[model samples]
Target: MRGLSVTETCFAIPGDIDSPTGGYGYDRRLLTMLPSFGVNVRHLELPGTYPAPSQGDLAATVDTLNSAPPNSTLLIDGLAYGAMPSSVIEKINRRIIALVHHPLALETGLSERRRAELEASERAALALADKVVVTSPATQRILEADYGVAKDRVTVALPGTDPALRATGTGTPLQLLCVGTVTPRKAYDVLIEALLPLKHLDWRVNIAGALDRDRETVAALNAQIAAAKLEDRVSLPGVVVPATLDRFYESTDLFVMPSRFEGYGMALAEAMARGLPIICSTGGAAAETVPDGAALKVPPGDVAALTKALESALTDKRLRVRLADASWEHGRSLPTWNETARRVAAAILDIPT
Candidate 1:
């Protein structure tokens, strides 16, 4: 093996570069910022069907890793790394850093056999890495407690929030926004159930995310909305472009994310960054992301609590303002993208800053 190169690192990511999700956003932001910190990041595009890779995909991944220059530092995105076998790990001679957005097994809708397999595979994969980087402290704790990863081996690099215009809600009918992919993990069903009883309230909701990810859930949700006669009050606009999403944030009065789990609640942070008040589930990293008293939180999958919180936020104008104010203050306190990149670079380069 050759001696290590201190100024360059390779990042391996699966799926499309344009995927509009938080984990993808994190990788994109980091790749954009790492070069400024004097580390040349080479992005290695892995096959899309990770965590369920075909034999061909696995062979391609093995070829990619085996072909990397010896002693080079490789940062593998968890989606690809978590499913990799130890035989593959043994073939790579370079230092490896695993970037875990969240564990694979925590994803919703997995069968017991699949979950156990993922848990075991991920544990083995993480064990093979030289360092592990998690996006939030909540995720870090989960690894240490549940996955048997040592606390010292893990580093937390919280996702960054860009500065944006604060929302100026249309006063007549309050605008509530939910930004996340429509999947079982997001618990849009719970959100829909919560919104069902609030039809009399002068408010409208827009769920902006990739509905194509789960067609069955999307169809069921559509049916639920139709059956409840909420066609006018609720809308699912599918994947939103940046300009349109900004407009939604700019005009929104409140943001809600009823996710059952998150490695880091990037959408929630974005909303807070834009000074939108929040009502989110206390699932995974959410409670840690939003400051205390800044937003209301309920146990995940608790429809009644979510409904009650929504009701309070809608009915009381002062409560909304107070939450928004606190949220804005907390949002201002989050680290910027460059800072996050710098932290990761420091971890990658073994530099203290």
Candidate 2:
């Protein structure tokens, strides 16, 4: 950490970096900025079937890990690393650091058996790493307290937010936006139910995320929207481009995320960066991300509480403005990509190689 010495490192991540999710976004941005801090980061695209890798995927991952340059550190995305067998993890020759967004066992809608299996595998996999880098303090605690990682071996490198044009209020029909995948973890069903009571209110919601990832959830959401007679007001524009996403942030009156859990709520951070009032559940790192009084937060899975918050956000213009102002003020204080890269680079440098 004394000098900005260049350190070569290989970062293995799942699927595409372009995937419209917080985890992928964090990886892509970190890779893009690490070079500025004298870290030579290499990208290794692991198989898509991660966190439950098939035998073939496991074999491919082993081959990839075996090919890393000697003395270079291996920084594996936790989605892949947490599911890898302990034998594979233990055999890695170089220093290995896990970049865990959150534990996979905490994902909603998993069977108890699958959850237990994930918990055990992740605990084993994490134990094999030389060090662990988590995105939030919440996840750091989870690893140390629950996964048996030593306190001294864990580091926190929070996700950074890009600056954005302050969101302008959309008059008449309030424009609501929720950014995240259409998965059970996001709790879209609760958001829909929360909105169900406010159909008479003038609001148009745009849920932008990868709808293809979870077809069953998409189908269920569509049916729920249809059943609630809100198809016209609610639209799911799947996996929007960056420019389009920027437009959504710029034009939105309120940004909402009803996630059941998050390691660090990047979407919530992005929303704050854009100066939009928020209504999100305090599931995981969400409360840590948004400052108090900047947004209306409720406990996860509480449809009634969400409904009440939505009613206040939609009907009370003064409250909305106040929330927006607080959000803008807080957003101005968020860390930039440079800072994020610096902290990550420092952590990487601190890792014994």
Candidate 3:
């Protein structure tokens, strides 16, 4: 496919675009950045009840999509796109471009019936897209292998990272930071268990992200912290503002993400952007997202392994410095938002009318 081109496309995203989650952040940035690269994008805000929309919301999704300019290409966010009825998907007049952050079936904690349903629905939805854009290579592979999408039909556009200042630790209690919504998939329970054994070490853990997304996970994590008597050492400062989050990145000594799966670890990339040493699990695209020297990789959901890595990172100065050095060097070369938009625009332009 050729590079960036001048083309009009419609991006239909479910829910509030201002949501503070990684997937929404990706979409927000693309909406802001794609236009500068010659891809004229018109935003369509679908009903927020997606991934499990009611019958009425499903009909609204179809109607909203069908209302787009007939000549414009329709780019649908996978959150809603994948769940659309195949019959309704075929009714839209515009050429379809599917942007999949990750397959919905890969999400943690789904029942067998729901998982099977999502798998079947997504497989059907993706087939109608003129082109598919995935946030990571791992996701691209998953679609091709499991969803039966052809290799040539998909494009891998890694998330873009903004430049950040290097972090300088607050040495008295080395600052540990984890960024992600408090969801079951994020595996905060595993993180809480892992950090339990390391309380004696000089570290204060701050989990920064929205807590309201999953009330059960939040309650469970709080219970774990209370039971472990880590209430003083660990804190969940939900949805830190941009200024405070920047301060967190600036002062953090180490970054950790123990997600059960990641389409692409945007938080990890943000950590690396700030030259912070990382400890993350090898789930989905997480392992490949951070280079070996840049992080202490552990198997996902392995509380013991995560605990060991945490202890080592906390106790050893040399390891943190070495990893940070690798991270700093790599961060300088990460793709910019423009590049991300360019790749997507190329995919959009590649679609045959």
lDDT for every model?
0.89, 0.88, 0.90
Return the TM-score for candidate 3, rounded to 2 decimals: 0.96
How high is each candidate's TM-score?
0.97, 0.96, 0.96
Q: For residues 53-162, could you state the per-residue lDDT of candidate 3 as single tens digits?
A: 99899889888987877678888999999999898888887788899999999999999999999999999999887789999999999999999999888889999999
As for candidate 1, its clashing pairs are none
Per-candidate count of clashing residue pairs (backbone under 3 Å): 0, 0, 0
lDDT of 1 by residue, 169-278 (tens): 87679999999888899998898899888888999999999988779989998998898888898899999899999999988988999999988999988998888889
Q: Model 2 over residues 149-202: C-alpha lDDT tens digits?
A: 998888888888888878896767899999989999999999999998788899
What is the lDDT, from 0 to 100, of the residue 165 in candidate 2? 79
Better structure of 2 and 3 per lDDT: 3
For candidate 2, what's the RMSD? 2.7
Model 3, position 234, has a per-residue lDDT of 89
Candidate 3, backbone clash total: 0
Off-target runs (Cα >4 Å) in candidate 1 are 1-7
lDDT of 3 at 260: 96
Q: lDDT of candidate 3 vs native?
A: 0.90
Model 1: lowest-lDDT 10 consecutive positions: 1-10
